[model samples]
Target: MARRRNPFDIFSDFEEMFEEMLREFEKMGPGEHISGPFFYGFSINQRPGEEPEIREFGNIRPERGRIEIGERKPLVDVFDTDKTVQIVAEMPGIEKEDVELNVEGRELEIKASRGDRKYHEFVELPADVDIDTARASYKNGVLDITLNKVEKNKGRKRINVE
Candidate 1:
């Protein structure tokens, strides 16, 4: 007579199998790059009454110095109002003296450097602004810039119909 197995035994079996799979993945050679938490090159495409197709979908071999998919760009906000244009940027770990701002025509350029880290960004204004009237302030890793818009003359010109 054979001994009966408990239904919960299947869960333990799955746990052991998962642990073994993880161990095998950890033994990957140095040439292999692990980009995700779970199994690599594992994908399943399924359809009703059709066999599932397994395929590899992501970058398995990445080159050195190449930007990763998870890389992030700096956060910036530009607000355009009737009288002024305001720009805000987040630059942590840098002092006010490390930052430089330049405005030419309709463009605003920002540059900052601190030790080994450097940042540069260019923003285009919606309307022509008075660069001389631009005001900027930096506080607690946040930089705020305000530019007064060039005033337009409201005088109407009467054009004779040709």
Candidate 2:
């Protein structure tokens, strides 16, 4: 008889959801964090790191919006391409309508609120972005933003006339 897949297995997809949850809390706001009592059985050295690096998402922080009964902090993902930078934020239990994206000079700003909770975020952009032509879109509890990189003149050339 063939063995059936166990949905409750530590390595199963169900457990992956919790892993995602932990990542979300790390990226969203500046607060305390704790590495999980993970059930996956992944070796301590094989995993990312045992250290719980708590980061405070500071710089132009937004005011405390509101708080709900059972709400978790959001998650954020940042990726950069050759000529563009993309930012994706996951805000579950919150609607896209409550999220806001803004680009100032060379910085990217993101704000989100759900129920009675609000989160403010700021990301500094590389020196290759044209804020005027940046684009942002939100769908399926995720916010996607693409910024175009600016073109600059190459380094100086030496001209010697003897």
Enumerate clash totals for all models, in the order shown. 0, 4
Tens-digit per-residue lDDT, 32-140, candidate 2? 5433221211221122655422322212112233211122334555666788888776655567688778787778778887655555667767556887877887888
Question: Which 10-residue span in candidate 2 carries the lowest summed lDDT?
Answer: 36-45
Alpha-carbon runs more than 4 Å astray in model 2: 1-73, 155-162
lDDT of 1 by residue, 1-162 (tens): 976668745344444444654665577799986453222233355667987544322222122423223211235667889999999877676899988999999998888877644556677788899988889998998889999999998889988998
In candidate 1, how many clashes are counted? 0
